[model samples]
Target chain A: MELSGIAAYLVSFFTFVGIYAILALGLNMQWGFTGQFNIGVAGFFAVGAYTSAILTVPESPWHVGGFGHPFLVGIAGAMVASALLGLLIGWITARLRTDYLAIATIGIAETLRLIIANESWLTNGVRGMSGIDRPFAGVFQTLGLTSAMGTLIVVTTFLVAVYFLVERARQSPWGRVLRAIRENEPAAEAAGKDIGRFRLQAFVAGSAIMGLGGALYAHYFGFLSPEAFMPLYGTFLVWVMLIAGGSGNNKGALLGAVVIWSIWSGSEFFMSAALPDAWSGQSGPLRVILIGVLLQVILISRPQGLLPERAPKTVPFGKVANRKERA
Target chain B: MDLLIDLIQLSIYGIVLGSILTLGAIGVSMIFGILRFAHFAHGDLMTIGAYVGLSFLVFTGAPVWWALPAGMVGAALTALLVDQAVYKHIRRTQPVILLISSFGMALVLRSVVQLVWGPNVYSYTGGIQRPWWFGDIAIVPNHVWILLAAVLIVAALHLFLTRTRMGKAMRAMSDNMDLALVTGIPAERVILITWILGGMLAAGAGVLLGMDSRLTPTMGWNILLPVFAAAILGGIGRPYGAIAGGMIIGLAMEISTLYLEPSYKPAVAFVIMVAVLIVRPQGIFKGTL
Candidate 1:
């Protein structure tokens, strides 16, 4: 590959990784901290993508648009839309078990996809929505920087900002309460913590982050499609990344995103190069199988994940002394 | 009279579709009743069964009826293998982790099916069968067969649960696992029975559904939401409830298309599911979670 070609490829690759990291981080908040099983991450992502696409894209024959609105307006709209959806679903299934939420969320995700695919007036159906602008595309081009490189810079900076915010929340008193509720719901409830309320908060916040990631992805790609947000590629892949990277830790989520995306994209390159023409058609399914097997192996061997959550170092000495005395 | 005929025709369509959904719902509800966690791969297991039926029809040159049974057997074995290889070990972990494992298993099952059958849609037979008229309404022979098969299976399941010792033991296990174990019900035996029955019924549902329409790689997975809605609407552990729930879901979905777009049919099932969950979390039949 040529120098610029490699740089562009790397930029595109990192941009995707950065986008997925945001998704994984959001999932970590829901599943890891709140013990809320949200298997429908793609639904929130799509909501963000479509909301922004509609907001920023030019007017078309089918659906209403924001008439080429500013990029910030699109991003904010995406987050709000996704967050509202999250809150609605969260409130409805809040009292149910984690498994119920999982099933409901999956149903929600599938329904969202169906609506997006079928509702031509809103989503333009199968033809998809295109021609959205990247942030500062004109300025970056004038400065002789490639659009890919510029997008990567934007995405990374956005990712860093999100990471810092989530990390701060993870260390806060509210974060402690989330862990408390996750570890022992009864105890948290007994301590006067409104478990459902806190859970809904986590769910909403996480979904908003995912929505932001979707907005970034739509702007960076300069296109949006229902096909781009299929659960197989969108939701399940994020789960695999979160699980492999260690669910509870923020850094693990980022590392998992990078590592898993590398293996995922790398295998495609390897398979294309290694397989003969006849065998190349099966490459997509083969990659899926590999990830599936990897998930199984990881679950069986390292259920704590590669980077398990660290224990909080704030236990009272008096409680330890009391236990020691009783023993 | 014309409207009545249309309504009846829609009901027939609903019943045929419901039979398939009922079979799947029964399998899923049975597993949840006994195993105490959702098997996320259950839909893909159905997919595996449908694909197996297609293979038997294509490779072995078997008749559709015989191929359906062969598919059931194949799916039953696959379910047993999944139990032994994955679920059994994961049972030691939390139920949530077990649920995640099932998701992984779904991925594996789907990919394997895609690898073996490829992604294109296939059918059991080449030519479409003409519908048999029932007075003013019409139904396909496959629909009749599907309804018959569902009735027979549900009757057999009832007899097994009510009359047979193993069936009663399975019921006892579902009612109270600790008490059942203390009363000398072999947990392994009950678990084994659950997987076998669940697998058989799921396979039957898959093949029947395939026979009705065309078989796609995503046939089972796509139908999952409806099956789940059925299972939940019927009450989680009640087989009879699943039957009723399936019919309700099927009828609602089809009938709603009369007023709404055909594309929004699946959404009808979802809306019903959410409403049921909100109003009566225990389900219409009042089965425990």
Candidate 2:
């Protein structure tokens, strides 16, 4: 392959890494800071992807696209859509136990997949909606940047912007409220923090960020399909990335995305190459098993990922922890 | 008259589905009671049981009914191994962490099913059975077995919970963990039994489900939400209430087909679940949580 080809590949790799990093950051907000479990990351991801795809794609006879709008419009729409979903989930589950949130998230994600698959007028059913274009592809030509590099640059910009915003939130009093709630909901409530409201806000904000990641993926990938947002790729992998990279640490979230995605992609490449054609289908599940076991190992040995969260100084409770690390 | 017939037929189907869901809901409720977390991997355990039963049939040429015990045992072992290997270590931490681990375990179990079973749909029997009918309503032979097994297992569970000392311990643990521990119940032994019972019930649900329909890698996962809905409706940690929840949810899901497309059954479940969460988070029964 030419040097340009290698450059394009690396750019594409970084582009994906950046997109997933944004998602991990969003999850960090909900799970890491607030301790609100959301297993339905894929639901929000799909909503964002489809919302963006429908807004930006050319109108079609089959599905609910063909608006042919700008990429940024799609991205905004994606975030809004996902935020709405988050708001609903947060409003409902915020008042309930964390487990209800988890169950409800799974339910909502499954329902979304069903709608995307069954509602032909909305998502073209199973055939899928395609023809999504990158953000300002033609304008990047003047910059002497290939479409891949342009995507990489745009994704990086989003990642950095999100990182700053998330980091800023962490340092803010609002972030402190969230951390307080996660550490001890009863204490936070006693301290006059509206646990429900803060939780709803964090959940919605995190969901919006996930939606942004989904929109970026849509614009760069230029296609929309249900298969693209399986829980394995959309939800589980993001959770793994967040936890492994060290939950609550934005930098760790980013690092985990780059590291885990590389391993995931690399393993896929090897499995495809090494396995005979007859056993091709088995590799996917084998990889899943491997990842599952890896999560178990991480939980047992290193519950705090590679980058342990630099938790702000706060009082801790022993309700859920026997080994509390005071920061 | 036709409408009435349709309702009756649908109700019959609902009862069959309800019976199967009850088996799963029982495990979920009991696990929640004893373990203090929603077992997300439960559906996958069902899948594991279904495939294990399939293996029994293929390897030993046993009757389909025999696969029931074989699958229950297989699922029981799987659950035990998972708990011992992963969940036990995390028990000292938060139950929420266990929940996350269970989610991962769900995926792992599903993938393992896919690997061992080759991702192809399987059936206990290829030959179609004639429906046992009365008037306009028809009951499939397989459904009879499902209902029978469900009733028997539930009865046995009722007895175990009330009569046996171990069963009392299990219930005691669910009723009040701290008090039960203070009363000198061996928490570890209770936890072990809980996994075995939960695993067996989950497998029973899975095998019966396969008997009713076709067995696929995702068979258990597909119904997990509905099962959750049932468990929630009955109250999270109340086993007997789960039975009532299962019956109601199963009936509602099937009867809704009268006005909805079959594909929308899951959405119906979701709607009911959300409604319950909004209106009465404690569920129909007083939830231990």
Candidate 3:
């Protein structure tokens, strides 16, 4: 279309990239650092989006929003709700085996979707909630900030803040405990660590971050729909991101999200543009095939991902012994 | 009296559904018992079996009874091929890696089904008329057949496990692979046989499920949660326990619809599964995991 139109699309794409990066980082913390194979990130994401939308949407019956408060307050509320839900689910399922944990998470995610789809009173059912006012609309209008620029500023600021927080958490003693639990749960337990509690903490913290991403997404779009939280879109894509990224590394998570999402978005564009008339109608199935193929190829070629986690270096025991002997 | 009748009707439907679940659970339990990893692709295998049955019915214009065997055979062959191609290759890998691979396989199989079936629902029997009777306690003829087939399959499985040489080898492998190999049981051959048996059971379950409900590309996907729930609830590695667990879950899901919304049936299973994991992680039946 026009130059401005293309620029607008690019801006929106970057905003999405930032939001997904946040989601990937949160998932990386849970699965990579904590060794909790949670396949349910989408459920918490839906909870966050729906929570913010239900609260802030105009003329809703379920506890009116803080008088159409700013987006930050809604985001904070979504994070708290998501974190509490994560805590509850994690407490129950964290102690189970990895496969059981995966199943439980999947079940919870699906059930959450069902509730959102069917609970008409709270979420407006399948009709979803709309008319959510964007943050700083008046300011943007007065200050001459475009919609694209406004979204970019808000999303980028949040992304940078979350990145720093995740980095700090990874360097802290808590992060060490989480890593220890991941590497050897029994040993960590023997070292007087409550494995379940640490895992639950990581899970909740990560889920809260994911919830923050969801709230940002809702506000950016100015609408909320249960369809947006379908398991395939939300859960599978997050798993793909975590797996494609070196799971334990924050940088890897960011890179993977940007790369995979670009591929996904690019494929949609390419398929719709290039397919012959006869086969163009089947582009949806073709897109799914492409994703499935990519997942298999990635898993087989480098299960540890492109930038696998590096082992921490330690002084050799023999060298240490020799030095002590010489001294 | 009305409540009693409703309960009985629900129980009957539960038993029919439970029978299909039992068959699928048997395969899953055996795979876990022998392979020592949860095979997530088993659900897709059921879908594959249903599709195979549909193909047979369409091509051969065969009776549903004949199509059932064709489906079972097709499924057994597919399982054997999958085992040779994927599972055997990853047999030496870490259990977690194998688990992840199974998830990949599940995705691939589901995609293939979607590609072939075009995301539409299919039925092999073409909506057979139910023979209703007994004053609001109606019974479908297909349901009776499914129940009968389930009993026969269980009986046959029990006999095979108890009385046959391959069955003994299967048990021996499940118990200790190294010991079985040392005893000259041909571990690879026995494992192949176990997969074949598991595939047959899965196919049987798939066809029966298709008879009960329409076979959408997502039919197996929908039942996967319950199947896993049954397997975990019964004890992951115990075939008999899986059977009982399937029955319990089936009954629980059906009965819950009486008090709760029908959409919440799977959630009820999930809650029970989580409760089971917390309260008795080892499951009600004892199996060597």
User: How much of the real interface does each model capture, measured as fnat?
Assistant: 0.67, 0.86, 0.44
- Candidate 3 residue lDDT tens string, A1-327: 699899899898899889899898889888888888777788888888877776676676643344566677788889999999888888877767777777778888878988887777777778877777766777877889886578778888999999889877887778889999988888999999998889999999999999988888888888777789866678767777777877888888888888888988899889988998867766766776677666666766777776787544556899979999999
Off by over 4 Å in 3: A61-67, A311-327, B84-87, B176-187, B287-289
Which lDDT tens digits does candidate 2 get at residues B179-257? 9999999999999999999999999999999999999998898899999999999998999989999999898999999
Residue A139 in candidate 3, Cα distance off native in Å = 2.8
Residue pairs with backbone atoms closer than 3 Å in model 3 (clashes): none
Each model's Cα RMSD = 3.5, 4.6, 3.7
lDDT of each residue in B1-289, candidate 1, tens digit only = 8878888888888999899999999998888888888888888999999889888888888778876788889899999998998788778778789888888788889989989989999988889899888698888888898899888888888999999999999888877778899999989889999999999998989988898898888888888889999999999887789999999999998787778887777788889998988889788887758
DockQ score of the complex predicted as candidate 1: 0.75
The DockQ ranking, best first, is: 2, 1, 3
Itemize residue pairs with steric clashes in candidate 1.
Answer: none
Per-residue lDDT value at B3 in model 3: 88
Q: What is the CA-based DockQ of model 3?
A: 0.50
What is the C-alpha RMSD, rounded to one decimal, of candidate 3?
3.7
Candidate 2, residue B281: CA error in Å? 0.5
| lDDT winner, 1 or 3 | 1
TM-score of each: 0.96, 0.96, 0.92
